[model samples]
Target: MICAGDDDEDPFPVEDCLFAETFSQDTAFTLFGQELRIQQVFGGNLGVAAAVWEAALHLCSYLEERSVEVRGRRVIELGAGTGVVGILAARLGAVVTLTDLPLTLPQLEANVSANTPSSGWPATLPTVLPLSWGQDHMNFPSDWDLVLCADIIYLPETYPLLVRTLAHLCKNTAVVYLSSKMRKEHETPRFFEECLPSRFNVELVHLDGSQNINIYRASLRKDLSQDLD
Candidate 1:
């Protein structure tokens, strides 16, 4: 329902727009037993990426409920948007890197700074970086324990690039956890059905039928792993 881009011609679902307006500049969320204050920028050139999506919250809940082992792990979040999921992972003791497009970094950085503690965790603090999928993915280290993505597969044009980036980042035992809303208009199924399976063995670990959101766990295919080596 959220508009994908800043184009005037882009279709903006009325219900989604109304939902967006319900938030103030800063919204608070309780995840992983901590309160996080996330700043949201609406109706800008940033589009839907500036706001915290339902998929991000659902992913956070899944991680918390499943007791995912992120502690002391090398985790990176792509298309981080409001930085909620990555920040939550950091709170859970992971060395997290939150990445998004160049324009989205400022807000993302702000949210990370506001939510993340100044110090005291055994793990390294979360870092923020700008990563455009496929364009500069090679600049990043291929060695990661976990790759987190939330609501990033809406744009079909970026599907191949996203898959390529995932294939590169998920080396050895690295796993990817992606949460997305099943919006038919955005062709959300195509990324899971076609793009991701091309590089990784993807599984639907959880599904929230009420919200139409899905959480997928993916790992590099054995064949692709051999090819990378």
Candidate 2:
């Protein structure tokens, strides 16, 4: 199923045809303390991921009251399927870098350009690039202050790659924010539970009143010695 941000110019027409929907009408959501323009898409088998995005947006609104040094912080988002989380962070004063597989870069950039109005991006808006997990380390400014991913831990085979990518990108005190719907039936929660805590201090933030969905926050443990093993 195609998520809401899938582009129309996908060259792999066969793979592109696998998705049922195209970019939907632009919808507005406030995430990470900034107003973001979003397109709701069909997650197909990844419906839970879409739900997680909704939950994160709700949490973002609630966190607005309490500032947490986001201004001018370098950030990177991995497996940015729909670019929702990354784009929102850019609006919230973080210098975000959005990445996904090369196939998804066009859609990702389209999403960024669509959300970012011509009035001009705050000098803090993010840059979009083709970053695949475990492919190669991105040569950027410095270690990221924050790394974000929404519903990225869906495949068990992807765990090792994600760990390596996160380790290379995050700073000593970097905080990584990940959100999911806890879809136990899909084995996603189990995948995260078994893999993430080995290197990060995983915390399940209860996204209760503000939104009707479940979400969590995982911050990297500063002292982890997780190796390439």
Candidate 3:
């Protein structure tokens, strides 16, 4: 069933251990004059996926203040666990595609539908699809202006495939934005530098505290690895 919560309620009980395990809710997040309702898949408090989405929303608001128009852009968010970022992008006027592994698509779709824009707003909401990082290339749209991902790089096995998928799917002008909480040795930037030399242009734009999560703008360019020393 669909769980709902008001603005002031923390719904998840931090005190009780058992009550925190199974319940999930659709929470409302407001920023930049846009009210986005997102679904928390695993219940309790906001998980790591939603936390990263919160950070991404903050960054989006920061950019919006600087006159960066997020509206009417083609955006794709990979590994969208709870579909928070992509759904927010749609609410802000972008045509977004939210994708994750096949198993996660159902919940993702529910989140997308739960957070859809109002009637007077934009007509097209985000499209939810099944896209495994390196496995399935089942008809993705070309010429995307922006690609977003959050908290997907913790697993080292998926590094190469992630880079290659970004290279193949994103256009030359496409900006890839990613955020993650890395372990002590699992630096996502290092993974990008190691794998992106041959096919894409990689630049580290922002790094959060503790050097764990980072924002990168990866664009497609020729001979991008010339400076990979």
Candidate 4:
């Protein structure tokens, strides 16, 4: 996604992205070649961390196309609403950990279990957890090979901590894939400016199948990285 303050090219513009569809809590969809069902909570009952946003759709498709490279990797997905992106990663053969706010865990777990049922699911079903960005108490395994986040840069107040969390967890051997709708200009630029140049190399991915959403691949910079303490 184009950072809000960025003057660079806004590739893949979404001229008609204003109109979005509403779905029932339980719905069926296909990602890549896999057919899956998910349960999502919406309306007043759903929090920002629980809604199935558009960015995840595009992220899942990209994962499908890059399935081979994703296989056997240990992935951690932040703000994993409805568990869609992580579920797709699990389908792509990655060991995935899907996380959201504490309140969102039940819903994320439901979708993860529903889509990857025990009958057909292998022993490696995705793990669901509560993770507030920048919170050190988040109980997750270390050494994540890949980190995925979508639509998380909308809040400016959270950007500093969010970027810190991203950089901290993704220190070594982490290829971070971030997807988000390019909105709230200030927040986006703050995220890129605070985190990218020093600790990671950011690459904009041209996603083919979505509107108003962007994909970025951030590889940790080994040479220039520091704890920044």
Candidate 5:
């Protein structure tokens, strides 16, 4: 699965294989006028959550193009794989928390440390934490101003859990920005069409036809917010 760089004429090059074998590599991205070096680990013990996906890049472009203001806001990125989105949020002045499974925390922390230097803006570094959706979401406070999710809605099994965690974290005026690749085979459409709307007021904010990716903005429905209160 995971192959080395192109230099090795390996048939299964790991440059962008979604489910490749065990290999380590670094890729660079330019966002918000800064170049970010993202280290990606494939296969070994990691799942598809190790590489930087196109959905993440698409979401980052959306943020930058729309000039979304994240300055001084409390932002948390759920299922933050390579920490790119959260790191960009930090670069744009938001206090960010990049969270994922415990197994992914080490790489996430390393990415954060690499992109966000000590002299970075906002004066505070992005916090990396271990967060498994719906299991221990209660441990985190429900006071985020913005919740960022990139390419997280793929597994149908995690739909309920993901929604529960979203409802628990997005309280008051908090909003969730989720970017997902629309794969027909996967249950991505069901999550956007039915699951997410059941709990939050979901809206289609942006759509990338070329990539079949959509960016959705969601917030706790009035009734859901009342129930949470």
Candidate 6:
């Protein structure tokens, strides 16, 4: 699906891949029965945000297994590095949006454009936008069927903002599929402390052979984020 690291996925060097000024020529993968080509950029051009992480691959497989549920749904993939998960959802007929930091747009747009099935590019090409965590809340849509993301919790400090951002962007009824490779053990509990049993409901999504990695399914308990002043 979306392979980059070995099975015991070590933390990717974000400083090198995201902050280093460089370019990696396009690479292709078969995800959800469709092939995708991604053009990766690093350094000033882009960051770790442009590389296809291993969690993305696992998420792709997970989504493919549930394609029937995905079709015709309103989906958004945030922190959409290289757009693999979002593109996969689009391939399955979901109306999808791919969101990431502003710089990743070049690569995100390129990957979606080049890999879209020839017969359905216009309909399948996703809306690309910048969705910085914990920042502006006005730009994002309030309704979503599913919000998808992978390997987004590498930075421990951003966990609260990420949870808050999700609460703000998704409807109380929406589902969120978030996959995280445990780069730092403390990070997840920190997230839970910030989000659980209060603003959102969360559960572990067990997948075969991925004991170290976790796929968490979260949904808002109530639309309490809007009450913030």
| Best of the two (2, 4) by lDDT | 4
List candidate 3 segments past 4 Å from native. Answer: 1-21, 43-55, 120-123, 223-229
Cα lDDT for residue 60, candidate 1: 93
TM-score of each: 0.88, 0.74, 0.75, 0.79, 0.88, 0.82
In order, what lDDT does every prediction score?
0.82, 0.60, 0.63, 0.68, 0.82, 0.71
Task: Write out the backbone clash pairs for model 5.
Answer: 1-21, 2-21
Instruction: Summarize candidate 3's per-residue lDDT along 1-229 as a digit string, tens digits.
Output: 1121333332211222323575566777676677767666563433343333444654465455556566898888887777767777787788888887654666778777766555733737678887765566436754788888766765555667677678667644677776555454656556766766566767776666754555666776755422221
Clashing pairs in 4: 4-185
Error in Å for residue 55 of model 6? 0.5
Which ten-residue region of model 4 has the weakest summed lDDT? 10-19
**lDDT (Cα) of model 2:** 0.60
Tens digit per residue, CA lDDT, model 4, 43-147: 323445445677888777777666536778888888776778888778767888887666567788888878875465443788877676666523444488989
Question: Given candidate 2, what's the lDDT at residue 51?
Answer: 29
All candidates in order of lDDT, best leading: 1, 5, 6, 4, 3, 2
Worst 10 residues of 5 by lDDT: 1-10
Candidate 6, 33-57: lDDT as tens digits: 6888877765544556767888888
- lDDT of model 3, residue 199: 69
Clashing pairs in 2: 4-41
* Clash list (residue pairs), candidate 6: 18-47, 18-48, 19-43, 20-43, 21-43
Give the root-mean-square deviation of each candidate in angstroms: 4.1, 5.6, 8.7, 7.4, 6.9, 5.9
The parts of candidate 5 lying over 4 Å away from their true place are: 1-21
Judging by TM-score, tell me the better candidate of 5 and 6: 5
Candidate 5: count the clashes: 2
- Rate residue 149 of model 1 by lDDT: 92
Error of 2 at 109 (Å): 1.3
